[model samples]
Target: MQLSENLSPPEGETIDPTSRLLAASERLMAEAARRFPIAGDPHSRAYWMEAMINQAPDYFFFKDRDSRFLLANRAVISDLYKETDLTGRTDFDLFPPELAQQFFEIEQEIMRSGEPMLDMEEKIPDGRGGLKCLLTSKLPMRNEQGEIVGIIGVARDITERKRQEQLHLGQAELLKMIAVGAPLKDVFTALIHLIEGQIADVTGSVLLLDPEENCLRHVAAPNLDPNCFTRIDGIPIGPAVGSCGTAMWRGEPVFVADIETDPLWEGYRDLAVPYGFRSCWSAPIHSYQGQVLGSLGLYGRTPGLPSTTCQKLLGMATHIAGIAIERKQAEDRIQFVAHHDVLTGLPNRSMLDERISSAIEAADDANGTIAVAFIDLDNFKLVNDSLGHHAGDELLKTVSRRMLDKLRPEDSLVRLGGDEFVVLLTGPRRRGEQLSVRLESIRKAIADPVLLEGHSVQVTCSMGVALYPGHGRNATELLANADLAMYRSKEIGRDALQFFTAEMASSAHEKLRYQEELRRAIAREEFVLHYQPQMDLKTGHIFAVEALIRWNHPERGLLMPGDFISFAEDTGLIGQIGDWTLRAACRQNKAWRDAGLPPVVVSVNVSARQFQEPEWVERVASALRKSGLEARYLELELTESVIMADVQQAVALMHRLEALGVHLAIDDFGTGYSSLSALKRFPVDRLKIDRSFVQDLPDDPDDAAIARAIISLAHTLQLKVIAEGVETREQLEFLRGAGCDEIQGYYLSKPVRAEGIETLLRIPNI
Candidate 1:
């Protein structure tokens, strides 16, 4: 029964050590089973025990009460004892002093209690200069009389399982950081560190793609050399660029097993190889939309292809990095949009107050003067109304650029909505003429002619200056005073600058008196509309009439809109007055049609404030309904500035009004700014060329060219173009020859009363 020598493979056959050991274990178990009936057979028992101990794959051992090793498996011998015998030698002879002491204490406890310890986890040297985790079990070994004689132990390596668990926990922690919106740099550094921990002898890095520069820049390099990292920070991405740069360029994995031999690393080899890096593997980080956002790199000191598991870890890391980077970039874009103007990409009102406040603080520390200049482009509306919104936008951009060129590097310039901007200049006190000279240069720069929409256009700005600590304190006061000064410049003559003074404040008070009068005048029904007949260019007959509002003042007599309209707008009374004008114009048109006069569309000018009202479209509908005028007889004219301010909103509103059968026309078409793409989306029926373009028509080449362009653009869009302020036959003839559809000016008839319009309508060929 104890006839086995040693288990071995069959003759003329070959097998791996693991397979050979497994076969030997099976044979030994079978022999032990057959010999188990021989009671007290010492030879058989010794042979069976020795065979099993030497052939088993796991570490199996036995020790006496003193914890000396009586037996050990081949696995234990190979890992710990090597060529030396393990029998009768305690764990102290095989392991370090601390490990041996721990084993002896555990064995003594098992022996004393006659019990077993199961699945106890412990770390031990793997004999390869690394640690290995084991799940060990120890039990008391008893004799025939049930008296404990020794302790038996068995252990299985669980290093891989432990590694997986730690990797999962680390990944979860990183995802949590990303979910909570941790800074990108912090997340990237932590991610790189995690990757490096999971892979051996490798440094991890993250390189973000800078699209503007077409380069890969190091965002995170947890263990790479600082000097080398800096040198490769902005490496240009190309097909043959180093691992990270090439990976991003190709949008795929790139593996360079040897830095010195791989052609992809030709130029970058010096940056890495000299620093102990011999190999690099990179995986591209891509956005959900498949755009290459960045790349994750694992750089190794040894040259070899990554194992399958290592490559899997790299893939997962890149995915997580992409999510973090994309989220951060989206947040940055939102922040930028919130603070910048969508039109010109300039800091808007949201940032203006903060910038000015900061400038004020800096000035206070230096006992300096700060000039807040309010700039209004004079006749900018005319440009918009003449050239169309597209031209207007180009002119504004040109003006903005010219103005920026004249400002100091420390100065702040902000666009405060249509045709208005605020400039902040800071310097020592009594830099008086210095600030003025800058403003003059800005003025001259603006006055320089620039081509827009094929026409050479020149624009001038009116500037109002208010000094901090002099024109009152704070952003609001300074801006208000500067605005008052700007208006003074407009009043004296446009293209000029004026400093805020006590007299300007007095004028503002007088305007308040006029505001109240204008408010009451609305309630008293003292406002009237004058009809300016628009003549059809082909038929030479009045087709549509523009309704111009007139205020009948109790003391000042009849006043033009320019006299008080701006003040009304400032006081927020324009909405009520505009509503009255709309209703009156609708009623007069309906009354004329009922009186058997020729039916014509009555166009009413809508102020920017009125057009911006949430219920403006409904208001227009109500006017037509209450006045009993067919919607076709009414047209609402909105300025280009108003319509272009919020194109999406304006488009939706215009469509709704058009559904009600009311036509829309862009009033002062050339003066405001709009892109051609956006213009085509508008639901408009006409383009009214601003009078400023027609005032010098047929003579001023720029004006004539602008007028022709507007006419052509309108007709191409299947819309009508009307020339306003045509005071002479020569202007009318030019407009007619240029394919203009209609003309409205003194040449036809100055804006007249409803009776005058009726009389004109009754005349033949009016």
Candidate 2:
């Protein structure tokens, strides 16, 4: 049969056309081949087939029923044997012994099961010296009778895909650990292991930066000698330093692929060579604000560049380090503010209170004693008033510093408030004198002058020392007793120190009781007013009566002013008692007026407390109105102390009271602290010479001269003069000869009730 005739086209009308001729020729060949078979030489047929298969680009091969290669294309032959004969050779015979064995086992499995194996990984020899990883597929071949005869396989290289798959798996494991929120150390360790396991010949470390120490500390490392990493724990960051140090110093990533040759590691080469690390890559751990916090690094025994994945892992570690550093710093700041004072930078009141409480508990536990010394600076107000508050504040701050320096380190100094401080000393009473000496030293230290604004200002402090289990056993009692002692020190002339005593407590209790009794005495009408007639010395006529306070006690018949007046003044009870005296004296004088007795003026002494009351004027006016007495006949006697308390307020109050038609007299005029300036400023109608001046008037020349001078001064000021405590006739004669306006004393008559005064008034003149 003719090949061209058998390939002839089907019947066509136009046989002359080239297309029709070619088609007819093909159809004739096809008919001939179908009707008859042609015999050919084996070598020619094989040569033609081999040429056709070898011309293909893909690897092609045929295997016998026994799973041995019968024929392989040129591409396969070249891939498997480097252009050498691979036909009629099994995979085991063509490749390295082990790899070839694996391929044959796979082929045998495919043939025995009559199943095709697709995309199987196989290693083929490159014929140079190494092997190539490839993807091969084996398919079952069948004869015309549909029986499996051999296997046909095709292969394509997939070494790159397999490498990518392994890399992906390692990255997935790392990401899974990160996503689980593992501890920082564990995460870092896992990362190191991942790099050393998947990547080639690598060692790595993490270093945390210590800002206070100005150094980097190794925190984690894998595949490195412990001693090598430990020695690098506290390395200072600088230029031309090792890889981690340099990265931290520049706040950037540093790569040294050849550690032995890199200048950055010149001084640190010994550390690398012994541990077999030839390359290192370091990335600085930095905060969001761009502050370098730490570094993450990779070390390799061989010279190599870091993969992009490794750099990305380092960046993640840097972020975690930054967060940790910020959190730790924030916690430190919170703790500092909690325990420190903002203004003075000293331990604040909270710290003081805690220390005191602990000391108290300790003292109680050990049966030991603790002393709390309460100190108040004397004359602090004068400094504030004269020099200004700024100077006063400076003085206080200086004093605080000095006091702290004077105390023992174990002792505590606390500022209670303005001009007040407390010092706490805790220990056993092993040396009483030693403690006293220490305290005296402290007092002297504080008493030293402080220079402020180029002025040497001397400040002295009064201390009140209270001991635990002696003055008080608790904090409140100790503070109270200390405060009480401090007041006592002030009363006894400040710039002194006093220990809490039982006598002070007793006296305080008595004063408190007296105050309560005085309040009740005013309300219960137990208080009475006595009248002592004030006679006109020249006319010998009773012109007025001075009212005196007398306590008509239920137990003790009649109590003089000497018994309770001082106590009343001290407890601030004098105001209430004085108000009662004013009303009673006015009412009694009105009673006498109604009874046809002389309409003489009634002088009632006003206490300092009463005079200082804001409503003193109103009180006086109300008293006169209620008694129906004319204000002109009422005389209000003010002591020198009353006007001196607040001179301006006193002058204003006196003027207001005087404006109500009441006469104001300065009682005890020459015996008080009133300045001559204040005397002229006061609005008074008369000056009453104090009894001290008149008691020795006739005997003592000084007393007589003082009385005369007072009378002369009163006349010069256009004010009348009255001499009180005129007990002797000679004293009375002296005062009269001195031209004193009025006289009132025991000689005329002691202070008696209103009815008794009428009897004395009715007596005829001698």
Candidate of highest TM-score:
1
Against the hidden true structure, what lDDT does model 1 obtain?
0.84
Compose the digit string of candidate 1's lDDT tens values, residues 504-601: 88866777787788878989989878889999989988888989999888898999999988878878999999999999999888998888888899
TM-score of 1: 0.58
| Segments in model 2 whose C-alpha atoms lie over 4 Å from true places | 1-213, 216-235, 269-278, 294-305, 357-367, 373-423, 427-433, 440-465, 471-766
Residue 60, model 2, lDDT = 88
Instruction: List TM-score per model, in order.
Output: 0.58, 0.38
